[model samples]
Target: MSDNLAINGGPKAITLKQEEALRWPILTEEDEQAVLSVMRRNETSLSEEPMKLEKEFAEYLGADYALAEINGTAALYAALFVLGIGPGDEVISPSYTYWASAMPAATLGAKVIFCEVYPDSLDLDVEDFKKKITPKTKAVIPVHLWGVPCEMDEIINIARNNNIAVIEDACHAHGAEYKGRKTGTLGDFGIFSFQASKNLPGGEGGMLITNNRDHLYKATTLGHYRRAAGLPEEYSKYQHTCLGFKHRMSPLHAAITRVQLKTLDEKNSIRKNNIEKLLKAIEELPGFHIYWPPPHINRVYYENDVVYRGEETGIPIERLIETLKAEGAIVRRDRYPLLHQQPYFIERGSNPEDLPVTREINEHVMALPTFPGDDGRLVEQYIGAFIKAARTF
Candidate 1:
C-alpha cells in the first residue's frame, strides 16, 4: 500500500490527490479521540465544540468573529447574501480562480466582472482591477490563488477607496500571512474550506471570519437560527428572521476540524518546507519557473501547471493534456474560465466583451500538484515528464 502511486484511479478520486488522500488517511489517535469525545458525550450537532472552534479560530485569525458553515461554497454564497449582493450587482474577481469564486456572484443574479492577473505572479492586476471597478461593482474578491497572497493591502486599500467589500477566498490558505495579518483577517469577510486535502483537513466544512458586526449579524441570520448554540441570547428569540438559510456545520466535521486546527501551523510548515525543496530542485531545470516565495508570505501547497516556453507554442491545450497524462502526472489546466464563457451563463445571455487577459490565461495555464504524501520527488518526476511530454508535441 505504501508503494502505491500517490493518486487513486477511483472514479471519485479524479486527481492523483485521491491516491495521496488514501496514503494519509485520518486515523490519528488524537483525532480519533476528538471524534470519540464528541460521540461519547453523545451530542454531535454544533455544541460547545463549535463555539470553542470559532472562538479559537477568531483568536487564531485575529478577527472579532468566526462563523462555521456547511462548506466553502456555501460560506461564499452566505457572505454575499448576508452582505446584500443581489441582481444587477457586480463582483470583481481575478479570472484565474476556482469556479466557486465567480459562480457565487452569478448565482445571486449578480454580474461577474472579471479582471486579469499579473503574468509573473498570477495575482490580480491591481490597476486593471481598479479600472474594472464601477458603481455597480459591489465587491472585490482577491483570491489568494493557490495559497499565494495577492497584494491584499493594495486590494484592501483599493476596496476601501471604492467603498466596496472584500471577501478573501482563503480556502487554500490556512496559516498564511501578509504584513503580519492572517489571510482571513485581512479582508472584510474571509472564507476557508476544510476539504479533505487542505492543511486544515476536515473532510468537508467551511468557516467565515469577519470584524464587522453587521456582516456577522446578517451572516448568522442567514447561516443559522440563533438556537444553533454559541450565539448570544438576544439573537435566540428571533427565529427564521429575514429569510435565513440552513447552512450550519455538522458536529462530525466540526470535531475533526477542531482537531485539525490545532495542527494547522504544523501541517502548513511541512507543506512550505516541501514546496521550497521542490522549487529549488526544479528552478535549475531548463524551461522552469517557480511561483511565489518570499519572507512572511507563505503558501499552503496546491495545484500548479508547468508552462513550457518553446517552438510549437500554438499547440491547443487538449493535445498538451493528453501527452502529460500519458506520462502519468495528473495535470489540470487553469482551474477556472471566465463565467461569461461558461455555457450556462452564455446561454442565459450576458457576455461582456474585453476580457482579453482572462480569455488568454484560461486557455494557456495548467495547474501542478503540491499536496501531502508529497516530497519533491513527484515534482521532480513531473519536471522530466513535462519536458518529455512537450517534445511529443
Candidate 2:
C-alpha cells in the first residue's frame, strides 16, 4: 500500500506542464510597447507617466487623489507620516500579515501594537483590534490579507468612534470589493503595491489614495517633492525643499502598470473562476478547509492557501507536503512569519505566545499556485493529488 503513493515510487498524479499556467504578471506586447515608449521618450528619471498612472488609478477606485511611489513600503511610510504617526503614537496591525503592513509605523518612531487575525478568514480580528487600541492609538492598518477584504464596515466604524485613522493596506487586494465598494476607497487612506508578484504588477511600484485633501498634500510632500509645486498655496512653497524622500515611481513602471490596470478586472475574474473551480473539487476532502468569503465581499487571489487539519487527519504537515511534492504538485507551507514573533518585535517586548490563532494558521496552512491563466487540466490533477494524499494518510 505504501508503494501506491507517489512518494514511494508510484506514478505522479500531476503530469501537465504548469509553467505557463502559473506564470505571473502576464506581460504582453502592449506592456512591452508601453515600457519602450517611456524609454524612447527618455523619461526614466521623471515624467508625466506617473501622474497619468495616478490619475487613472484614482479614477479606477473612485478616489479623489492618488500618489504613485517607488514601492509599497514607501507608500505605507508616507501614509503613516501624513497621519502624524510619530513618537508616543501607537499603530495597530495584524500579526499574521506582511511586515510592511505594520513595520512602517515603527520606522516613524511610533509603537506598533500587533493584533490577532481571524483564523478562518486570515483578516484582522476586529475584536482583537478594538482591545488593542488606546489613547495613543493614532492609526489602525487593516490589511486585506491575500486579497480578502477585512471586516471593513465594522473596522471603519470602530476607528471612527475612537477617532483613529484607518489605513487600508490594499496591496494584495487590487480590484477586490467589500460590500460593492472597492478596497482602496473604504478607508481614511488606502495603499497598494505594484510589485512584480501583485495582481496588478508594475515590477516595483506603489500608490497611496485618499479623499482628504490635506492627507493627499502631506503624502505628496513626503515623497514627491516635484509634485508639491502644484499643491495648494500652503504647500506649494515647499516644492524646492520638500520632506527629502524621493519615492516617485519610474515612468517605465508606470507605463507597465497602466497597461496592466486596463485588464485587472478581467484577469481577476479568470483567477476567481479558476480558484472557485478548485475549491469546488476539493471542498469535501477530509481534514482540508478553504475560507470562502461571504456573498458581499468579492475577493481576489494573490496566493492560494488551503488549511490542513494535521491533528485531525493524524498526518504531519511536513509529510503531507512531501507527499504532494512527489505527486508533482507545487506545494509549500505558509509564507508569512508572524510579525510578533520576529526579533525586532521580540526586542520591543512583543510576546509571540499571545497570538495562538496566528501561530496555528502559520503552522497548518499550505500554499498552492494561483494559476493565472486557464489550466483546468492542471487544476484537476492537483485536486486528484490532494485527494490521493488525504486518502493515503
Candidate 3:
C-alpha cells in the first residue's frame, strides 16, 4: 500500500474534496452598501471614497500620508518618479520578485541590479545588497516576498548610510510587521497591491504611503489630480501643475477596499491560525520544513510554502509535487526564474553568475494553500494526503 506513489501510476492518496473559495475580497452586504452609497451620491469618479480610503489606510498604518493609484505598479512608478530616480541611476532589488517591482525603475532608464535572496526566507540578501550598492545607487527596493517582511532595520541603515532612498515592494505583504512596525511604513516609500490575489483585494488598485509630506505631495499630484488641487493656497482649480499621470483609484475600487480594511486584521488572524494548524500537522514528517520568520516579525502568508530535502528523502522535488497534487492537495513547485538569467534581462545585457543557493532552493520549494476561513477538516485532509504521499515516495 505504501508503494502507491501517485507519480508512479499507482492509486492516489485521498479523493479530491474542494471547498468553497473564500480567500480574497470576501465581500459582505457591507461592502456592497459602501459601493452603492458612493453611486447614489452621484460621486462616481472623483469622490470621497478614494480620499477616505487614503485617510483610513494612513491611520491604519500610522503613516503621515497615503495616495491611492490604479495598481501597485503605478504606485511604485510614482514613487520612483517623485524621488527623481531615472537615467543612469542604479536600483538594487531581489531577483525572486515579480517583474513589476524592478521593471518600473528600468522603464525610467535606471539600471536595475538584481541581488540574491536568502534561501529560506526568500527575502533580500543583506550581504549581496551591500555589495551591489555603488556611487550611482539612487534607491533600493526590497520586496516582502510571500508576505514575509524583509530585514528592514539593516536595509534602512544601509540605505541611509549610502544616502539612497528605500522603496519597499510590499505588494505581497499588507499586514506584515517587522520589529513591531508595519512593512510599508518601514522604508522611505512603501507600495501595496489590491489586485484580486493580494491580501487586500479590490479587484485592481494600490496605495503609496510615506512619512514625508514633500514626497507625499509629489506622489499625490502625479496620480491624484483633483485632490492635490484642493490643498490650501496651492493653486486655483482646473490649473494643472507638475507633469502627472492618470493613476487615480476609482471610487468603486476604493469603496470595496475600505470595507476590506475593516476586516483585514480579522482575516489575517484566520490565515495565521490556519497556517499554524497546517504546520503542526506536518511537523513530524521527514525532509519537510517550513520557513519561520523571526520572533519579532509577524507575517501574513499569501502562499504557504514548504521546502523538501530531496537528498534526504531520496526523491526528486518535482516527483513529490506531482504526488501531492494527485492526493488532491493544491500544491505546486514554487519556481520563480532568476530575473538576471531570463531572456529579457539577457537581451538587455545582464550577467548571470553564481547564485547557487537561490537556484537550489527555488528548485526544491513547493507552496500549499492557506487562505482565510480554512477549517479543521480541510487541514486534516491536506496533512493526511501530504503524509501519505511523502511516506510512499
Candidate 4:
C-alpha cells in the first residue's frame, strides 16, 4: 500500500508548506493603509481613532456602550473594578482557560476560585460553578474557550439567583453566537482582545462592551482618563487623574482593528468552514473525539484541538502525538497550563485536585493547526496522516 506509516522511515504524509496553510490574522495592503492613515495624522498615542473603534465595535456586537483598552488583561481588570470586586470578594472562573480570564480578579484583591469545565465542550461546567458559589462570591467569569461559547443562559440564571456579576471572557470568541446572540453581549460585561494572534488581529488592543451605563462610565474612568471630561458631572472631576491606570488603546491599533472588524464575519466563516471540513474527515476514527458546538451555538476557531481517549485506542496519548508528528503533522499537547496549579494561585490555597474533570480533559487534549488560510490540500494530508497513524498503532 502507498500508505506506509511515516514513522517507519516511509515518505511523510504531509508534503505541502504547512506555514502558509496555518498563517493567522491574514494581513493585507488595506491593513497597512489603515495604520498608515493613523500615522500620517500623528494620532498614535491618543486620538479619535480609539473612540471610533469603540462605537463601531459596540454597533457590531449590538452593545449599548464600548470602551477600548490597552489589552484584554487591562479590560478584564477594569471590568472587575467596575463590578466592585474588591478585597474579600470571590470570583469563580473555569480552570481550563487563559490566565487573563481569572488573574484580573486576584489583582483586585479578590479570591480567584477556579471551577471545572465540561469534558465534552471544554466550557464552564455550570454544576461545578454552582457548587463554588458562597456569600463571598461576587462575580463569575465564563470564558468562551477556543471560540466555543459557554452555557450562557444557565450561567446567567445562576448569577441572577446569586446576585453576582457575569463577565464573559470572549477573548477567544470573535463573532461567535449563542442562541442567536453574540458571545460578548450575553453577559453583564464582555471583553474581546485584538492581539496579533486573536481572531480579530489589531497588533494589540482590547474592547469592553456592556449595556450598563454606569459600568461603561466606570470602565472608561478606570483606563481612559482622557474621556473623563465628557463624562457625567460626578465623573468629570477626575479628568486629570482618573483612577490609577492608563489602559487606553493605541490609535494605530484601533485603526487596524477597525479594518479587521469590517471583514471579521467573512474571515470567521472561512475558519469555521475549514475546521468543519477537517472535523468531518476524522470524527469517525476511534478514540478521537472531535468537538462540535451545540445546534444553537455558532463557534469560531481561534485554535483547533481534539480530545484523545487513550483507553479506547489502547495507545498512550504521547505515543500517538509522536507518531502523528513523524508523519509531518503539526500536533502537540494543549498549551494552556491549569491556572489552579500555577504557583501564584497555589500559594493562595488553590488545590490542584479540586477540579478533577478539568485536569483529566487537559491530559488528553491535543492542539492542531487552525488552518486559517484555505488549504484543502493540507487538510487532506492531515486527515491521511491521522488515519495512517491510527492504523500503524
TM-score of 4: 0.98
TM-score of model number 1: 0.82
Cα lDDT for residue 327, candidate 4 = 89
Report lDDT (Cα) of residue 68, candidate 4: 91
* TM-score to true structure, per model: 0.82, 0.98, 0.93, 0.98
Off by over 4 Å in 3: 1-16, 21-23, 231-242
The sequence of per-residue lDDT tens digits that candidate 4 reaches over residues 1-393 is 347777778889888888877887788999899899889988878689988999998898988988999999999999999988899999999888988899899999999999989998899999999999999999999999999999999999999999999999999998999999998999999999999999999999999989999898888887777888899978778889998899989899999899999999998887777777778877888888987777999899888888988889888889999888988998999957999999999999999788888988899998888878855778888888888888854
Tens digit of per-residue lDDT, candidate 3, span 1-393: 355666667776655455543345577898889889989998878787888899999898888889989999999999999889888899998878889998899889998988889988999999999999999999999999989999999999999999999999989998899988898998999999999788888878999999888788777667666667765444224237535578889899899999898888888888888778878777678788777888988998887888788887887777777778876677788788788778777777787665666777787778888756666567777777777876754
Tens digits of per-residue lDDT for model 1, 1-393: 122222223121122443652244244888888888899888787477767778888898889988888888989998899778989898988766788877888899888887888765666889999999999989988887777777888898999999999999988778888877888888889999888876688878899898987678667777687543345555545564634678778777788888888877876665566556656655564444566556767656554444433333554566666665755766667546566667766765546455666665555566655545565555556655555544434
Candidate 3 CA-lDDT value: 0.83
Clashing residue pairs in all predictions, respectively, total 8, 0, 0, 0
Global lDDT of each candidate:
0.72, 0.90, 0.83, 0.89
Question: Which scores better on TM-score, 3 or 4?
Answer: 4
Task: Give the poorly placed runs of model 4, Cα more than 4 Å off.
Answer: none
Where in model 1 is the C-alpha error above 4 Å?
A: 1-27, 228-237, 240-242, 293-296, 310-335, 348-353, 375-393
> Better model by lDDT, 1 or 3?
3
Candidate 1, pairs of clashing residues? 6-20, 7-19, 8-19, 304-367, 304-368, 305-366, 305-367, 305-368
Error of 3 at 211 (Å): 0.4
Candidate 2 error regions (>4 Å): 1-3
Clashing pairs in 4: none
Question: Candidate 2's residue-wise lDDT over 290-317, tens digit each?
Answer: 8999999999998888888878788888
